[model samples]
Target: MKIFGLTGWSGSGKTTLAVKLLPALIGRGLRVSTIKHAHKGFDIDHPGKDSHNHRMAGATEVLVSSPKRWALMHELRDEPEPTLEELVRKLQPVDLLLIEGFKRDRHPKLEVWRPSVGKPLIAAEDPTVVAIASDGPVPDARVPVFHIDDAEAMAAFVVEFCGLRA
Candidate 1:
């Protein structure tokens, strides 16, 4: 599967773009999946839940299932962190995979930039950044740029970049 990343400063609207792009990609008959990275501790399991108890009891991984949904949680447990490539390998095959973080990974990326955040631009330093989607006018770039609200254009960029049938 081809992989691409969407990255930006906090509140720069990466998730918003991702949310918009997924449906468009799916409409083009592509199977897509996403990997979102979180820096802070997060728990899908709630307190007083049986799955939470199982996890606290040293279970390395837990799969909770119901007719409607399923979730798999794996404990890192001090292990060396998995790289983006390794993580992608664990995912089922798809036409494209959109990764939200792992900004340092060498795969091609589309940066979501908002000048209001006053955050430095990563594309200026990273060759993996193939393009940018900006909430405001993007500075002159060596790669293509798209307005953040143009989900169709962004989706097309991704499809072409990946050489996917679209």
Candidate 2:
């Protein structure tokens, strides 16, 4: 899959932009998938759920399935965290793969920036950051800048950046 990433410090609206971009790209007739990286421990399964119970009972992997969807939860137990490349290989093919977080990974990314966040721009140091989407002026930035709310323009840039047909 052609991959792109949305990255920023906390409260920079990365998730919000990702949500907006998904439908915009889909509207343009492109198949899209997303991978989100969390810094802390997180759980998609809750207590008392069958899948949760199975995982708690020492099953290395628990797969929950239904007519609409299925999810596989693999317990890392003693294994190292999977690399970005390893995780990407597990996904089915798609026209675009929008990654949220994973800022340290060496992939093309857009930095979601907000001046109100009081954080310095990441693109200044990270060569992987190809562009910036911000609410305020990024006068010092060398890369392209787009208004944070301009999903159409951002989607168009992403399509061309990934060399996607639509």
Instruction: Give the Cα error of residue 109 in candidate 2, in Å.
Output: 0.4
Question: Model 2 off-target regions past 4 Å?
Answer: none
TM-score to true structure, per model: 0.96, 0.98
In candidate 1, position 9 carries an lDDT of: 81
Top model number, TM-score: 2
Candidate 1 residue-wise lDDT, 31-140, digit = tens? 99999988788888997999999999999999999999899999999997788878888888988999998888788999999999899888988999999998787776
By summed lDDT, the worst window of 10 consecutive residues in model 1 runs over 134-143
Candidate lDDT (C-alpha), each: 0.89, 0.95
Each candidate: RMSD:
1.1, 0.8
Quote the RMSD, in angstroms, for model 1. Answer: 1.1
lDDT of 1 at 109: 92
